[model samples]
Target chain A: METPIEGIQWNSLGFSQTKTDFMVTSRFSTKIGRWEDLQVVQYGPVDVEPASAALNYGFSVFEGVKAFRSEDGSVQLFRPDMNAARFKQSAERMNMAAMDNELFIDAMCKVIAANSRFVPPCGEGALYLRPLLFASNCQLAAETEEFTFVVFASPTGNYFTSVDRGLRVLVTETYNRSAIDGVGFVKASGNYPATMLPKKLAIEKGFDDVLYTDSNESRFVEEASASNLFFVRDGKLYTPDTSRKTIHEGITRASLIYLARNELGMEVVDSEPLTVDMLKSAEEVFLSGTAIVIARVKSLTFENDADQEYKYPSYEVGKQLKEMLMDIQNGKRKAPSSWLIVDVPSLPVQDQ
Target chain B: MVQEGLYLESPREDLDWSSLRFSYTKCPSLVISDIDISDGADGAQWSAPRAIPHDPLKLEPSAGALNYGQTIFEGIKAFRHDDGSIHMFRIDENAKRLQRSAERILIPQVPEEIFVRAVKMCCVWNSSYVPPYDSGGALYLRPLVVATEPYLGVRSSKVFRLVVYATPVGPFFSKPEGLAVRLVTGFHRSYPNGVGSTKMGGNYAPCMQSMAEARQSGYDLVLYLDAKGRGLVEESTAANFFALVDGVLRTPSTHRKTILDGITCDSICYIARHVLGMKVVDDEDLPVELVRTAEQAFFTGTAVIVSPVKRIGHEADSEMAVICKSLDLAQELKVILTDIQFGRREAPEGWLTQVTPSDLEPLT
Candidate 1:
């Protein structure tokens, strides 16, 4: 077994980049019709053509996954297959070359194993894996002929710096995350930049993040800036329907829904439109994502009417679910064989 | 003026300039500048622009541009005058538009003077690439800005890099005389509160699929309707739309906040009113039905100067309207625009900025 790296303040880690040791990279071109030259190189800068579609036309997509160091000092990843499948969908939507799921998972494992020392000790934090794919040719037009795929790792702690008393979120009608028929459902790079301004404004007003609404009517709540929203009414759980194509199908959100139905025996409703009124009356509210495991919402304010606010009196549901989820992640509780990848495949001898 | 130690290279002699197509041909040099928001009081600490060799950029794998799409760009053209001098038309407008795009995406705006200087320096350093006055080709300048800070969070980067490069490109459309356009429904380019009007990289990639489908169906371009489903004409994949109806020139208003404020479109409206003495109708919603019955229609942009529309097809309705009975208006506008661009006719004040080549002596 590999030893944890020295000189890392794992306990003080935050949701920022802490460079690791190695990264995996590959290239694809229309001429070759397949990904090639896969290599595990030192983590650093990569050369990119100035006129490449990745730079000129914003042709990029990415995925996020985390690897945890369990109680026995063994490292395991959570739902890497889900991230691989979603990465493929995002790549296809942006007109980029999609990497095969097997190759994607293998690369993730190889990168994490190469940097096993960076994984925090049990209960400290996790090593976050980022898989990025983009068009990488020097072209002036919209179509791309060459592509690049990269997977890099960063050790990070909780996404929210302060979450003891829950978070104050603002409902925004001034800006929309994405259009109805746009790339909201996909984890395209283009979908995130537009939210920066809205998020910054919310923070200035003493809120943690902005909860976006649908671009068509601004009536139904879509999701937060970076994560998916979940509401608890009485004893039932409700979330916005991903079938509307305006909300991202988050892997964490799906896992929680599964746990809520199978483990907790709670009635989960996910196919309904989650409006502001429905959310205001919810007994509890929380967000879910790879970066933010689960965060409780204490209050919500509407942008149009600052006088209007909704406060949640209880966060018991979110706290209970976070513990259950973390237990499975840290290998303390039993999980489906497919959910936790305990035996990470070693790097190929030739590649190593 | 060319900086010391930054000598200009001779124009490339390998290709037939007359047969060049709308594509990227590498030049010798490009101008670049960088800004680090932390270094300044208001996040406006921009380094002095410098000319560098045309080479690939070194970026971290997790750069904001690569991860969150914090990228914006502008497209302008430079013409070779009859007197063997290169000049850029309405470059200031491009500089201003780029600033507006930067504001929408939260990137710190590059001051107009810096933007103009970088573009001019890039053009002058690559003056040889400008096509001959009669070759009907020009040097296309692409000014791009991207957030280079390597971060995982979804916020504007405190660091950005602005680059201005030149590429020799022929006319944008193969058929410069006229083009066949298709009106696409059910696919919206920009929503009311989205970043549609901004010339950011994110706005272009989403429309590639629609453009490719239109090409497969034998159409030169696709026209989009408003995202709100209001049935009002928006714009084409790359350019703005205009039509001539009952002796009046009409186009969509920029106030809708869903379409780009095209500089070429602005110029055409001015020419139509002052030069041609025709009634120009801007600031109104242009419905598709009105354009179908119009006498003529065309597209205007920096790349496509003025491409007359011959036919517009809507497959869902099986409607194919022949637009141009006489191409006199479009042809006239194109000639006037080209004349001013190529220095054949007198230009209005501040319309043209000549890239002085005295300091860019060819290498011995």
Candidate 2:
């Protein structure tokens, strides 16, 4: 029977260790090693050795995928296969064990089926799925042979903690997110921690997120710490593609390209050498991710700017594109059947 | 003329030790001795470790080495031979790797001769911990170098410290059969144009969090690939990888990023290719599938000389099991290597260097 989640208020949510219905998990042991113990389970704290490699060395990778509860009460995953692919890519990059795609897909289905109730109803919110992998050995010389993989889910309303009119991005020249030959491309923990110093600086300067430049030149636009950026000039969409140095391969950004070209008939260029001047010329600027399908950019502050400032024309939430993306995601419009999957089990029933 | 640097004091000789355990615990006895020097010799006895216990050296939180990861270390075991003679294995190689690491991290260089002397002095001072030959243990020596200069920028450290510490340890692996391996697909351990080739503490620090994640998910270790996501292979967090594919021994080359040039890895390559008459290729030109499908996949390092890789995981390919008789070959190699280090067997090309009590005739 399908689990019912009636009268559950999800607004004003925070990340806490609360009891949950299910999670996706996998294990690698010395005996069998690598690809083993792939499964989904009820949510809880996993027993980890203090000497595990991840804690001391930051040897872990993760991906954020969302399951949407469509209007017809069906749970749908958007480009989950791509997430699986990237998950494997990240694991390989970190030197951790790679998860089998079949097992990963099965685990995802099981966890989403078990927690379908937590997936906010269509048009409400998204069931945020975090698929994580890490090294777990106690040996500390330099290399470890132990590892683990897990996928957890949370029902979230918005990715950005605070939803204001729009957002202001401080262009950081002193700080870098990742080096060209570094772990920047992988969604590894180390990549995120490196941004802490810069992110903190941006927050103190009263900005929503930081627009990081290239580590070497500090001239070209890289990413906005978390999500891929999209700029619309004369109604044409443009985004930065993955280079040897940067890591923002946004699934939502990819989806927008399809939406703009196939549905709206707009020229959607995927890769470009996005510069501050190009960003300034853009009439519409937005961020895309699994959590925030699309968000408008209010202003940009460059260190080299006159009075140390440059602003975008759009300070308000992007109206048309947001509706189009969300409408398709919520099953309000007829999606090109390829976007939807079916025959999934019902979610666990929960109390309000 | 004296070289200018930090001042150090020796350990107080009057401390009582009858009741205290000698085992190295999590908390060390407050760095009882330290010293600063700017010069040393070249060959056998590089330099002595000056003892200093007071006014421990201080460093800026954002020191170039801390933020940019400018550090290097060498692990050499002091084996107490059956004849009661103390000896070291391939000290020259360790010193060279240390210099290479320092260069990569953009730190000051330590002459090879000076490095050997400091390690020798530290081992002699802590000689009580050197286990008996029959006791299945040896004195583990770690010579660390880190930037200590006061600076907030990301450039190389203008000043650094060379530290040596010794502790007795049993086998690196608790089990005799050696460890199992897990192949990864997601994380690249190191990359080209990155610091993967060096032995920087920064490189190790970034891997800790992921290592934790790997353990929780149920794997023993991780194997990172190259950035191209192609057939390019690299070393693990601490060790280098080697495999026997169709009777040929192969491992990733150091031409790309994402690998540490391990001493053991080099030894195995020499023995397998030249001594054992096996085909060997150091570069990543070989197919990754061939490496994974090999009868045996093993990692080499100073502590764990050879660990067998049991299984490999990938999103695309099916899981493959390793089928090498690793124990038999590994045991033989381990015996040969350990014997040479302990002076039980004839030195292979002058690999062992004896460090007698007479070497410390004039103790600092």
Candidate 3:
């Protein structure tokens, strides 16, 4: 018998498509009024109404979490429970139907075990997991209807380009990502489109992405187009307060704060309104997300009442934070007990 | 099972035209206008369009259109002339509006030429389904652009699919009567910062609950107040509202406001001012006081056309109301619009696009 694992380049893979064999799926049957049991099916398209609320009304919410190969031969998940909780919370805010935490965990386990072959070797890359929930029932009227939940996996390395190149961002107060009172805090799909035009304008000016300010005044920081934001200055951390405004309170951002305070014994300052001047004074500015865990910001150019520019010469804090978070994710260092969910069965591929 | 090209109309089909309702019926052919987008690019570049057989789209379960709510659409109507020729009403306006919607939400814009051609293709292929000349029904066309890329990131999709399908349906209001509406204050349908003017998918989904609630309370639909001002009347669930007081036509302003820039509302204003030489006033002020003096009120949309308002009621209690006894002007406007639509009267320049005949006659 010939070994089937040839001609695959795992480490060189960028953030792109590599369809896994199966996808775990579930549906919120408006009939039963709850998420159904997870089922592993071949990855393909599903039939839907042309007027499905997910399409016509933007009633879609989702979460992104990653899985990695541990030093031992066992598969692992890094706090998938957090992603599930966020998805449930987002679905609720969007008036979408969602599943319970237990069902979410069970589905993840089944999906990881089913696609264990695609999990890259240690230090190569991680399997990107995407959990999505959307309205499927089609009607012109505005009523909450049956929703569908699906999870698909892809093997990828970097979300952005080379990690060493870092990022150059433009801060535009001309447009706000989300209204201060809108659905920005939730992982609502509708919230992202508002950023595309701003990012496009910034790209024309030779910038990588755009950072939005508060909608009302454009004074305080909100978030980047793709991910939540974090700044380290004078040994203190700062991010937009999600409780008051529409900032995506990401799990990766949460983990870094956890490490800054408990692991490294640093005072983390956040939830207070953060100003651009404070960010300009910061030693290092970077992003935190499940995709590009941490990427330093080389420069920030902004125009609110007037034009301003800020540059940083160091990635010290961003590097340290990335190492600490990756250590916890990749099994190189011990994680806080609540941060890892590792009982997923690692079924051995006997065919090889 | 639907046969090839027979999905539109059948010669042996049993039909009742008078009782036809506004509904979804499968068209035999679907026209597509699309573009190809790649990573690290600023925007998409649309390519040549095509038409395919009508069927449920094969979408990747995690397509951005499904999970990210990346959808924008346009509604158009095609009327059959007395001589059996089809004339589509104001398709170019819908095309321009669709592009605006695409830009606001970052979906690929359908070029006006491609949009019109695609719409024409769908209308021609489904020509058999264009309700009879005097059925008082127009074949409703729905054109939608959706993100088709299979991805997990909460960003604009790299690929998009533009599809247009036709549904033969009767007029929104079959009789020469008026509708009952209520003023809703509880939930603001949209904000000044929100994407309300464009025909985006998110704009429609949130209003369903409000509309359903209004329907159960013995009202046709609910009118929303602007989120920014909270005093200005914006729009009803699916249409734009206009108040006719004395001799002037007044309604909410959509310029910087969050309300939709309704094409029907635009056409109505155009006809009133240019064709009929009537005074027209467009403002965002609350119509509360004017409701008492308004001789007649009506809704203007592609679906509703010019549906007169029988009365206006409070959101909390439908019993509290202001009633309009006559709909003379409303009926007059409807006749003029429908007359031009069905080709009983000549339309202004470029208002109609004739659907040239072809040999593919499925109905025969």
Which candidate gets the maximum TM-score versus the true structure?
Answer: 1
Instruction: Give a tens-digit lDDT track for model 2, residues A162-225.
Output: 5335688887776666655556766665454345446656787788888777655665787886
Candidate 2 residues lying further than 4 Å off, grouped into runs, are A1-7, A14-19, A30-34, A37-40, A159-164, A306-308, A315-318, A337-343, A347-352, B1-202, B205-364
- Which of the predicted structures, 1 or 3, would earn the higher DockQ when compared with the native? 1
The parts of candidate 1 lying over 4 Å away from their true place are A159-161, A337-342, A348-352, B1-11, B39-43, B319-326, B357-364
Which pairs of residues clash in candidate 1, taking residues 3 or more apart in a chain or in different chains? none
Order of models, best lDDT first: 1, 3, 2
> What's the CA error at residue A87 for candidate 2, in Å?
0.8
Across A1-352, the per-residue lDDT of candidate 1 in tens digits comes to 4767888888678777888878999999989999996688889999988888888888888999998888888888888889999999888777789888788888888888888888888777888999999889888863698999999999987543456478999998888877767678888888877788888888988999889988878889999999999999979999899876678999999999988888888999999887877887888999988887898899988877689779897988788888888888877888865574655654542333
> What is the C-alpha lDDT profile of model 1 across B1-364, one tens digit per residue?
3455643344567768988878888888888999988665383766777779998889999899999999999998998887787789899999999999888888899988788888888997787798877888889999999989998767788889999888998877877557878887657777777788888888877787788788888889988988767778999967999989988899998785789999999999988998889999999999887887888889999878898988888666766455577667888999998898899888878888888745344323
**Model 2 vs. true fold: TM:** 0.54
TM-score per prediction, in order, is: 0.95, 0.54, 0.85
Tell me the deviation in Å of residue A237 in model 2.
Answer: 1.7
DockQ-superior candidate, 1 or 2:
1
Proportion of native contacts in model 3?
A: 0.46
- Tens digits of per-residue lDDT for model 2 on B184-212? 55555554444566665546655545456
Evaluated against the true chain A, what TM-score does chain A of model 3 have? 0.93
Q: By DockQ thresholds, what CAPRI class is model 1?
A: medium
